[model samples]
Target: MVAPGLRRYPVTMRLLILIALLNLPIDVAAAEDRRVFFGTWGTAKQCAREPIKPGGTFLAEPYEIGDEWLRQGQLWCLLSWGPIEKRPDGYFSGAHARCGEDTVRQYFLGMVLSDGELTLRWGFPASSGPLRQCPRS
Candidate 1:
């Protein structure tokens, strides 16, 4: 039985429509937001101040990534980091190189934001929790 004013789509057309709907992408902006790992991240006390001290002894871990480099200390050239790459597992990995000292080769696993808290997963299963982004001065 067909409605008076409604026309039925062919089975092939209906299948195409279903396929198109299934292949349609979710929110692209939201997906991109999840992948953002820029800016400085630290603990409560660390991020409490407007400008985080560059070389604070109290901070056990300092994580900062800029446009081209990842820094551990306040000084830019002190610690070296290679180009970071996003892995297939949705984690960023980079080589922490300390050139000209002992030629040490360290690595940064990745970082992710969950519920506004940024977590840095780097080395030996150690992850920083409840780290917030510091306000840029």
Candidate 2:
């Protein structure tokens, strides 16, 4: 009992449709969205130097933002971020949990990306100036 004017495809056509679906491209857009902020950002000197260790010198280390994780040399804070939300003030914000040594801290992150520079503001009265993307070694 077929419905009005609707025709069923043969087995060959069904197989072709399955093959076409399998040949579709991978979810590249999802990958791109996850890596939108994936890069190492810092001053030229920081980018050139090797990553500093925990409890090491207090130099302003660069930030390495990767898929779902971020790392900074100073204090060895490794941050795990939730979804980033776009704000009305031309910035993106997120809530992140940072783990360093024996301490864990939570903060709201506000970031602005322009050109190849990334500016970040978190914590009270603290901010990161314009940091440029590091060159690949």
Candidate 3:
């Protein structure tokens, strides 16, 4: 028979290792959660220079605003080059968002795409706000 002290040792170690292995992807993604936001045309210029999924966009509508943040605000639509990194949790991160001139009035934007939806957060020296995406087509 195995010694009492050693009986569960190997099994416990194996289980711990297994757990860590299972969590490996999440650990790596957590490390990549790091991100940055840009404002004005500056961030857009930089993102536009980088490689991404060409013709990306951020579209928002007034009535679609969730009840929690409800208002008859202006509808906004922004465009970008493409998809950024998609995390293990299915959240998408990307750089370089340019707002629609007439609708959004031209600002730098950052986006999180998931949940069959897109959420945009704009940044500027003076202000920022969360805007939901209304997909095209």
Candidate 4:
């Protein structure tokens, strides 16, 4: 009792809908796994009292802990105290402390620019510098 064209339309729409539903989770998972700041960064400018130097580099590794994407890395020659939280403005802020022969603690703030350059600052002794992204090997 149904028209020949109408029967194919319903089946076609259902197939399209099913395909979209199947891909939704995969698309979401891919987005969550991809991180914008996951790489090594280096600078040619030196900051007083900072560990990274004109030729030195640091690594940024992004991981999901709970419901947040945290970027963890070493700065000023010490491991970060905790994961740095990314802000709405694309900047990350956290605290780090180093212990050994000389103990040091600092609050860290950094941002990745549109050109892929990184700018960082460490409180106390006041160090700030610009870093460029390094090529992956």
Q: Kindly indicate the candidate among 1 and 3 with the higher lDDT.
A: 1
lDDT by residue for model 4 (1-137), tens? 99999989989999999999998987575445334544555553221223444455543332111222223343233334334444555544343434233665434434333355555454534543355655444
User: Residue 13 of candidate 3: its Cα lDDT?
Assistant: 99
Give the alpha carbon lDDT tens digit for every residue of 31-124 in model 1. Answer: 3433366678777566554244667545544567554455655534233333344445443434343323345455554555555566666664
Q: What lDDT does each candidate get?
A: 0.54, 0.65, 0.42, 0.45
Cα lDDT, model 4, residue 79: 32
What is the TM-score of each predicted model, taking all chains together? 0.45, 0.57, 0.28, 0.35
Measured by lDDT, the strongest candidate is 2
Worst 10 residues of 3 by lDDT: 34-43
Task: Show model 3 residue runs off by greater than 4 Å.
Answer: 1-78, 95-104, 114-117, 124-137
State in Å the error of residue 68, model 3.
28
lDDT of 3 by residue, 1-137 (tens): 87898989999999999999998987565444422222222123222333334565432223232211222234434444233466654464433433344544454544554443445555634322333333332
Residue 78 CA displacement from its true place in model 3, Å: 4.8
RMSD, every candidate, angstroms = 13.2, 8.8, 16.1, 13.3
lDDT of 2: 0.65
| Candidate 3 colliding pairs | 53-81, 53-82, 59-134
Model 2 TM: 0.57
TM-score top scorer: 2
Task: Give candidate 1 regions above 4 Å deviation.
Answer: 1-35, 49-62, 74-101
